[model samples]
Target: MKAFITLVFITVTLATYAQTKYSNEFMNIGVDAAALGMSNAVTASTKDVNAGYWNPAGLVNLEDRQLALMHSSYFANIANYDYAAFAMPLDDRSAFGISLIRFAVDDILDTTQLIDDQGNVNYDRISLFSTADYGLTFSYARKLPVQGLNYGVNAKVIRRIIGDFANSWGFGFDAAIQFKTDNNWEFGVMARDITTTFNSWSYDEEAFERVQNAVEGQNQELPETTEITIPKLQLGVAKTYTFHYDYTLRAELDLNMRFAQNNDIISTSFASINPALGFEFGYIDMIYLRGGVGNFQNELQIDNSESLSFQPSFGLGFKYNGIHVDYAFTDIGDQSVALYSNVFSLKLDFSIFR
Candidate 1:
């Protein structure tokens, strides 16, 4: 087991090295923080739950105070993540909200190299590496009763810190429009990551030294360095019909698209049409079941003629009072079980101000 873990560490290091810093590291994190993450979309217009994270326009329809917390993570050794939020309405025309999210990879053994004057490699401190992502957000939504539509905007300032190496500060804003049909068919459009980003490499000695060197062979580097922006656009539609008094079947479809600055990276710009179907039969909304599959865009054959493909994912959750817990599983086969990874998260939410 120890050897397997060590091998995984090496593989992850090299895999991350081949790509850019922070590549895909934060991609799968913070998903379980929202029940919507479990079903791609949960009863969207219900008070201002974490559902807002998936569709900002949903905030416009909230009626009262709502708070939520979600935790989930994966990998063989386990990576931890956290997400939380609160939202409410004012004057029957506007709403406000705030949120927090985190990503942490713990117990990572730091490699060390010691040298005796000759600058030889020597193992040193047994440390770990970690990173966290958090954002303070404010949002407002106005209802146009004449058209039965809602238009909203959200502003968030984000901070990303990675160990002692890199830190970044940026601002983002999202615009969303939502409206429902006469038959209660809801539709929403949202665009995310529309702000500029700058990563503070100076926060770390090692990363800064590398930047300085790159500038040596060229013109003076800019005072503040920045990375490319990754933007995501999504269109969502959902409809629900009562199966019983308090029981209902909710089906949602989201056409999600994320594009990177580099066009040659064809995979980054591709879109995923995620269809999630869920059934909620709770008497007082105390429990839920959610299952969905995504990331199955392509098929590939392994090196030796064996074929490998992206696997489907499923999750389950239960809620009581104001707290919730969830778990997700991905099956990639027995040999690939170690890489399949299981994600588990806990959510905490409650109403405080009526």
Candidate 2:
């Protein structure tokens, strides 16, 4: 019972904090090992099914039906993240895509009933529950008459659940544009939650009564039930080069911008910007190696001194007969603050059937 009360307090505190900053953060964790390997720097050069989550405008480049799946674990496997997406060209210059993402922590012990009404400790009274977040995105992209420009939009629905105790639903929209230059340079812009996302929460009062009674004057009232996610933007540029006839190299840089100042490398009262860089090397378009560095932040050390930290990721990919298998070693934060996780993803190009 004590543990359960503590958990409730922590959950409520985190929930309140999230309402003002980093709301719906799971959606930003990203999908596809190929992008994660590049520390999420593929905004300008993403041209596959995974583009639905990165920069949907790139989907217009698809020539055939594509399906992608990815799975990754975080926090020492305490949490699991999964993604699936499908995309197909609608015509010579248009495309459509759909994608789903889920992040969850399952089988958490419910200690609220550790003790019976008679004050008797009963081991069998414990139960389990899960907390999860889900996002569904519908995307559309079309090539514009202006030379190499393409534009896309996404309608997203979000669901959040906390073991039947609480739940919330949200909706948002995103817009993006991708342009390719005659000189092989690509530029992309993604505006996430452009109109702002809103989540309305509902809690079961009966289910929360236990938490209310667990402490005096603590959690006595339900938490605020509304959360707002502000708009964010990403700008990217990429270029690819081919040498030795069969060797190809691609490099991309992205600037992720947030409306409010934070820990990003470039911080201001109006906006904060974080830069990411990624590189991919391909041999005969079959075997590939990738690397990236991003998520730069200033950390306060034990002695109150500030130090710069960043995350580095590496990945490998293989392609054969329209099948692509990729693996990535990524760290959400500096090695000292977080552990590296292994991610695997698969992509299938249906054109192989033809």
Candidate 3:
């Protein structure tokens, strides 16, 4: 039974890769508890090391060398995700950042050997393998001549591996801009995979043969080896309000747009747009609370009725002397799927050591 299930899993995974949509999805899962807690609505307001992933243009706001780390588990602990980032000012007008991300499912039982050549069940032959994806990003940001304006770009490399069965390599680029007004209003835009990322895959023939033989006539041939990811755009607006001298509140809204039509809130032949809203409350810039809602979708019910669904997230944060600790209770999918996960992240300023 276990071997059969593993075969089915591999078949489904390969099949999904044939489609262009949602390719390299692990990279979109996001990083940092604070950003995830805000449903990734920080494109216009991010300013720390995490900006290397969110909106590199915001890196211009960094005043000191910074480092960040985060970890989270998904699908009831069946998968794990990890992220790390570092950013520093190159001068008064330019900044540089680098980030790394990994998502993996480990210790999967490779039950191909569960049955001996004599067709007898033998648990002793079972082995373990893992499937993992990795991303490395290099980002650069610079202040423009126009006051309160900045531009940034990212060069990314992608790696994917399925134990000893298959592996792939990919490359992509991203561009972004951020602007701040004297009235405290902020705006930002980001273009992901602006050059259309491409992944080329290679398979181990012997291992693939085992997969094909496991399911008669089902996996008769190798799957498509090339995958493409199109461009995606995000636009954001934000503002901060101060109540008295110690209390503050920040609100942000973002529109995530994809060229192909889908189940998003606003869908058309040309594009689909999903809107996200987030808010943060701070006291003396030390303690914080955050909340957000996003991922709007239209789903068909069992009775053939249509319904709307969304994902909600909340978070808490504390900062003292350049150290920040954040926690978020969030859902990766919509309410219908209910894949909730706990995320934690830490950020530090190198200036603290000096």
Candidate 4:
């Protein structure tokens, strides 16, 4: 009962700050500094363990095994997001990976509007709770008999909890396919939440009921609702160029199209579509510089003018002796000045180190 009440507080706190495009919005934030640095435009160019969350087919690039961990400071230190992934090559033709991510806010103080019989504010009744979102995914990829063709699928489980007020469980599926050519051109197609992910929420009304009589002026009731996250199709293409100086340059583009309206975020009258572009420059495979732009939206108008929304990102990376560290700066938009997010990630390739 205590846990449930705490969760209720968490739920209310989360509802006050939710700014999402769909259900399970945390999953859409993207994982790993390396990818975010490029505005997550590497769907076709992605390789290694992080592919567990991107294009699983990219796991084929792992010779043996790889592990990656990432952390992000989101939205002016209001929340923290973290991810970890591991990929292992099962054989020459198959690979598998697992990934986990968590997003949460802590130290929220909960208060009541009810006043005691003596008309004194209840100072001893303050409660603290946290709201968090979690995702776990299992993925597998296989190379087809046809050269340069590969396919992958992911099974995901999701859970969201609010201090004790509400909790939810959800399931979803994702699939991806990729084709590459000897000339360094790659193409990718991905279907996210192909099964139309649904979240079932259950709320505890005990706390609200306890204060109902005292706070009758403000009518409030715990709500029980189910939310569905619509599916989206993403198409991507990338090209790699190799230089005589042992350097490489790559460019990538991606388009995301929503098939259904997300009542949770955008109005049904508006369309949800966006394009992203990214570039990366690498020196002897040891150092890299990346930059990109994403979240282009022009559907709604604010102040009688076409509302503009876009996020710009950039990053740096270092790799040597089987270890890599990466950092990224992503602008989340104006929050006073321009709010920039900082992300850092580390990766270890056991194939080379062990």
Best by TM-score: 3
Q: List per-prediction Cα lDDT, in the order shown.
A: 0.53, 0.90, 0.92, 0.79
| Top lDDT prediction, candidate number | 3
Using lDDT, rank the candidates from best to worst. Answer: 3, 2, 4, 1
Enumerate residue pairs that collide in model 3.
none
Q: Return the TM-score for each candidate structure.
A: 0.72, 0.96, 0.98, 0.88
Query: How does residue 47 of candidate 1 score in lDDT?
Result: 29
Q: Write the per-residue lDDT of candidate 3 for residues 86-114, one digit (tens) a residue.
A: 99999999999999999999999988767
- The window of 10 residues in a row where model 1 has the poorest summed lDDT is 214-223
The TM-score that candidate 3 achieves is 0.98
lDDT string, candidate 4, 157-215, tens digits: 99998766678898999999889999999998888999988887776676545434433
| TM-score computed on alpha carbons, candidate 1 | 0.72
lDDT of 2 by residue, 155-235 (tens): 999999888578899999999999999989999999999989998889888777765654446654676787889999999
Off by over 4 Å in 1: 1-39, 42-47, 116-129, 195-200, 206-224, 260-284, 302-311, 317-354
Instruction: Provide the global lDDT of candidate 2 against the true structure.
Output: 0.90
Clash number for candidate 2: 0
Candidate 3 residue spans exceeding 4 A from truth: none
Q: Report residue 330 deviation for candidate 2 (angstroms).
A: 0.4
Q: Which one wins by lDDT: 1 or 4?
A: 4
Candidate 4: clashing residue pairs, number? 9
Winner of 2 and 4 under TM-score: 2
